[model samples]
Target: MTQAAAYSAARRKLHWGWITPPVLFAAIIAGATIGETRIPVATVLQVLGNNLLGTDYAVGRIDAGIVWDYRVSRAVVAACCGAGLALSGVVLQALLRNALADPYLLGISAGASTGAVAVTVAGVGAGVISLSVGAFAGATLSFLLVAALARAAGGGMGVRGAGVIVLAGIAGSQLFNALTAFVIAKSANAEQARGIMFWLMGNLSGVRWDDVWLAVPAAALGLGACLWHVRSLDAFTFGAGSAASLGVPVRRVQIVLIGLAALVTAAMVSMVGSIGFVGLVVPHAMRFVVGVRHARLVPASALAGAVFLIVSDILSRVLVPGQVLPIGVITALVGAPAFALILVRGRAR
Candidate 1:
């Protein structure tokens, strides 16, 4: 094909890429309508429209409350968490140039969990900092530690350095996980320990609209920040030396992108504990659908991740009927096999 025609065809494909987001939105709506009470789709729509658009449409007060107050908020939180985590994965994979890189893989989740556990179990920062703030601080500290260790091991900018970073991350994760466990074991009452355990396992139940406000904005901002660095990410895929030669300010961009990824991971984990697999698997899945270009991959991954988690959250609710499973459990069950398949395929290749 001629260059212009090929460009046109690619643009057309990109336009078709728009379909995923709408489908995800539809899935979110469908998920919101499902629960123990089983709100109808039409009632859910009416409630959402009346609240969001100031429409005159009416629904049963209980149904409206369930849809508008409970289910919608939970779904939004799930979507935001999923999108943020997946976007974090995309950025980290590009920054580290490692297909296996994920938000949790780098100790961010462990750090967040540690910080949260410290607050909940030990009350270390109870008066001074909230759990969410503590989690963010811990996540930031973990990323800094990993970066510093990787740099010390041998500058964290190339393939060798990526390996060092991964090793450092594993060490950091283990350390934080140990700290979290110690805090829970030593200080927490049985009830507190159970709550901590449940949070660690990743429950989205009882999330309020307040959480929606915190999570959605953070996720949106993080995604915007990552998208802003798309050119830099693209440049880095060729190596730090190549990116620098292309005027990408390789180290600065890497730090900024990684920090953004950490921020997204911290935000989500703070609200809902460390849910796994969305970050690890969603990016790869979206890459298969949208190709490897960061511009397409980032947004597509965000939408797909949102959809994946929303559906997973619904399954978590309905799986046992009247009892909710931890959303993280569901994701791990799905993601582990998906990851294994990816590994097997890679080996075959």
Candidate 2:
């Protein structure tokens, strides 16, 4: 690369680095500001200042509680879920060499959903296992199942069986989804069923500080894993064989990255339920903006996903005056159309 081009790239990166933090912060504050009860942006900021900066802002106790404990926590969790899922999508797509590869498409979400349902309805853990644990276990199991099926179908390391894996993933997703539904049908009462169903669609209504702790670490771990393997991911762009020829540790890379994808996806799905398309949409969108380099694409996708989900959460709260829609519904409403456009555009090319 020419010095001039390198200098320009550095400048661009610095500019975005300066801009993205404030944009993301503003979106989080916006999420806190607009809700069932409209709060001023000023009040939201004051609440944040009091809680985060220990400033005495004289904010009303009720308003402060609402902003700090409820809205802020929810928005932050949404951001974490968004970032984590998006990173997973980026990793899966790069490693698998498939544009359609994502946690949902790979059956991770379905497996998590099944695990969560099993715990909630079937009482599998019988008060010993948390929903997140169950979900993670299910996600790991499902991934193993899908991997085995793909391998059985003649798909192995590299891009040789990329299409086969996707098909296996679809089959795995259907099977797990059916299991979830069966559990709900057999074990849940009316109220339990309704709550489970809503949660299945994705709910952030009960998110709090505890969830924030889980979400932040989960997202951070995913980002760490992705950033750690950025070069290997770049090598993976051509094909697994190409990556191997370039001295990438093909099997180790696949195991570590894909395993982290499943782990992170399961964690987020456990907390937020099956919010779809984030892993599928955000990375592709970022690629258009940041180009295909994983160094840029990974972080860019994480930021965009965070803001996208925060905005979606806000819309869920205010879209109906008396009723709050599930966050998953809002995501699907936006994502499905966006995905179709991606498909149409891809086809046109």
TM-score of 1: 0.92
Model 1 Cα lDDT, one tens digit per residue, 223-321: 788778877888878877888899988778877778778777887888889898888999887776778878778778888788888999999998898
> How large is the C-alpha RMSD of every model relative to the true structure?
2.5, 2.0
User: Model 1 off-target regions past 4 Å?
Assistant: 1-21, 155-159
**What TM-score would each prediction reach against the true structure?**
0.92, 0.94
Across 1-349, the per-residue lDDT of candidate 2 in tens digits comes to 6999789767866976898789889989998999999999999999999988999989899999999999999999999999999999999999888888999999999999999889878999888999899999999989899989998999966556888999999999999999998999999999999998899888999899999989999999999888889889999998888989999999999999999998898899888899999999999888877789987898899999999999999999999998989999999999989988877876896
TM-score of 2: 0.94
Clash totals for all candidate models: 0, 0
Residue pairs with clashing backbones, model 2? none
- Per-candidate local distance difference test: 0.84, 0.91
